[model samples]
Target: MFKRSTLSLGGTALCGALLASGCANHLQQRSEHEERVERKLLDHTLQVDIGEPKSLELPQRRIRIHEQKTFEVTEFEVTRNYDRYTPYQPWRELYEVPLGAVAIVAGVGANILNVFMLGHLPDSVTKDWIDNGVAGINPFMNIQSHGRAQQNLASIDEVQRDRRTESTSLPWSERPVEVQAGTQSYTLTTDRSGVLRLSLLDSPFAEQDLSHVMRLRISVEDDQDNVRSDISLPISGSLRGKLLEAHALIYDDLEDDDVSQWVHRVKRLSELGLEEEASELEQSLIELTHNDPELQKQFLKSLTRDAGRLVADPQASN
Candidate 1:
């Protein structure tokens, strides 16, 4: 009986030892698995320090000045280039004068002369005199008169006529046209052949962030007449969605219309929680082009060169 009891005690001790060893092995495996999962999670997550978006700054304007001179003694030509000058000087004048003071004086003199000579001036002339200067000086009158001028200018025909009548009409062909929205600005130009070109005047955003799908509406007008209809094109999509989805609606071809489309896409992406994915896709599309020669050439031709340049720049990365 004593020997049997001893054997039973030995069996119990061996079973307990095996169970403890098994438990330890299981716990160690679980710990190793957890460590591996943590490492993988850390590896997949992007580690980036995204600073505040930089504000867009406009580039300095380039101006070319030319001089013409005629001499009777000799038919010699002398050419000199001068930098562009601003009407306002850096230094403050001793007697500070507000803008349009001269115009105001001239306008008042003309009104007085007309009233004295004609005994009564025409309503249009009277209104012009008031709107031009006399009214502008008074805050209340300025608002009323400026409203009328804006109304008159809103019409295409009236704007064209005003430009022709006013000696201050800008030379649209020679002038550099640009538009600003939020932090971005775009410069527009037309070649001799009349092909429109657009460039980014200021771009402080990451190129990848700019790759969301966009719609552009372009319209051309000449002499107060519609020369061309509006064109809507979808652009700057991810590599997977290169083509812009078609829309049946037709809007005006103003640049503002294109801006509206950009806003719409951004809103949609934000709602979907796919903003990061969209940015990544754009980056991938940019990288892929460099690997494929045919794609690089085709992309440059189809897409505007400016788009290609923005995507290609290494500095454009966040």
Candidate 2:
């Protein structure tokens, strides 16, 4: 009997040890899971998007830069709150029971009296108070967050960081970027929309020898952070031909051709996407024709865009 008692005691002790070991293992696993989730929530990435190819004729705009940030969310939690209404509110039973009983009796008497009266009654009079409490509430507006994303989002922002989210794309507004074209390098700043705009004629490309200039290289670097990008574009052969043709037209006088050529070339150049060249040539055309009303009208009919923005003399208006 003593041996049996000793054996039973040993078995009980073993079971207790196993239970404690199991509890510790579970807690350790839970702690490890929490650590992994925290690490994943901190993961983030930034992507840079320069403008797409400007057009089939042009490679890209003079400049453009936009940024998008991405966040990694792994494990998260949320709290739910609701005021579910039903006819089974036991807490209001004391008052509701008496009211419901009275309502049924009144409804029957009213219906019987309606046999001689109008014979029609509204549903409110027949419905019991318990079921008709705010009868048919609109659940649409009832669902609301405690506050702005007041959920496990707070836990996701473990560092209390006020960072941009992917809900909307944010521009790299008013940021300075470095651009290098050929032998020239310049610092250009973006606009309010984070778009960098500079006319090719107004940029360093104007000074660089285009006879053999074949590629445009753009680089954006930030010393304060890890933002950086390098972009290279090939100056297509067709683009070069158009640029040189426009340049040649700049030196040739508008009067070198006949009277019928008053502004035809200007119109043609503008059509070829050479607005700056067309604009310069139109100035000569204006002087050649002295803004004669008839000729001005002819030019006006032919002109479009920048070349057309030139003013005709008061004589034309008269």
Candidate 3:
């Protein structure tokens, strides 16, 4: 009976040792899993957007010149190109005159007279104006009257670029994360904001611009361990380079617009050594061509048919 008891005690001790070993192994695995999750979150922080683009609009004036009874051409004029808007008034009123009141008043009167005859005022004592009158519009005119109408067009081209998002956080979940958007489902971790962010797992656009739209979701899980709902949000891409500027001209075109006007504007910009502006216009043309195959065909056909008139001849514009 003592031998049997000894054997039973040995068996119980072996069982206890086995349970302790199993517990250690389980704890190690849980620790390793947590470490891997931490590393993954760190790596995915680079995937968040810099920021959303802001919308910008500039006031423009259209001029139609009738040369001869049979011919007319349209020209575009930007109201102001200065970084900021300034109030218009007499020079004396805008700036302190170094000279006495009599000289200041005389100078102010002359400046006002020049504006009436020459269509523009002298630079204020406080501000210097860079005139683009050749491009159109007298630089000054807070002329105390005239109401301007600003339109917020509900078109895709009206959007502009602004600051980008700098950083974002990753989500922490115990189970394998499942993200659902509408009828579709994807597995992804959440960000600090509790939003599931998608990463371009492979750096396909490492060299090129990662300009693409993303569709994200807000997911809810049910008691049965199934996704109940995924409210989707479609995010637009950031606007960069001259593409952002092209949108303004694209939206400005009308149904009966003439291609020659674009060609002429581009030509003038090039002549003035405004390489950036010229490039923007050219890019706009290329984009418009890509959007409409028939337009592309027609544009190319015209280039070939009127090569001399469109490009080579000095007095070729119609």
* Best-performing candidate as measured by lDDT: 2
The sequence of per-residue lDDT tens digits that candidate 2 reaches over residues 191-247 is 888777754444455555554656666666555456577776556667766665665
Error of 3 at 277 (Å): 1.4
- Judge candidate 1 against the unseen true structure and give its global Cα lDDT, from 0 to 1: 0.33
For candidate 1, the clash count comes to 0
Predicted structure with the largest TM-score when compared to the true one = 2
Better of 1 and 3 by TM-score: 3
Candidate 2: clashing pairs of residues: none
Q: Estimate each model's TM-score.
A: 0.17, 0.42, 0.18
Compare candidates 2 and 3 on TM-score and give the better one.
2
For candidate 3, list the clashing residue pairs, or say none.
Answer: 50-164, 50-165, 51-164, 51-165, 171-190
Model 1 Cα lDDT, one tens digit per residue, 83-154: 221122222121222323544676567778787778476645544544445333432222122222211111
All candidates' lDDT scores?
0.33, 0.52, 0.36
lDDT of each residue in 124-215, candidate 3, tens digit only: 42112112111112222222111321222222211222322333333232223454333455554444444433332112212223234244
Residue 197 Cα positional deviation in candidate 2, in Å, after optimal superposition? 2.5
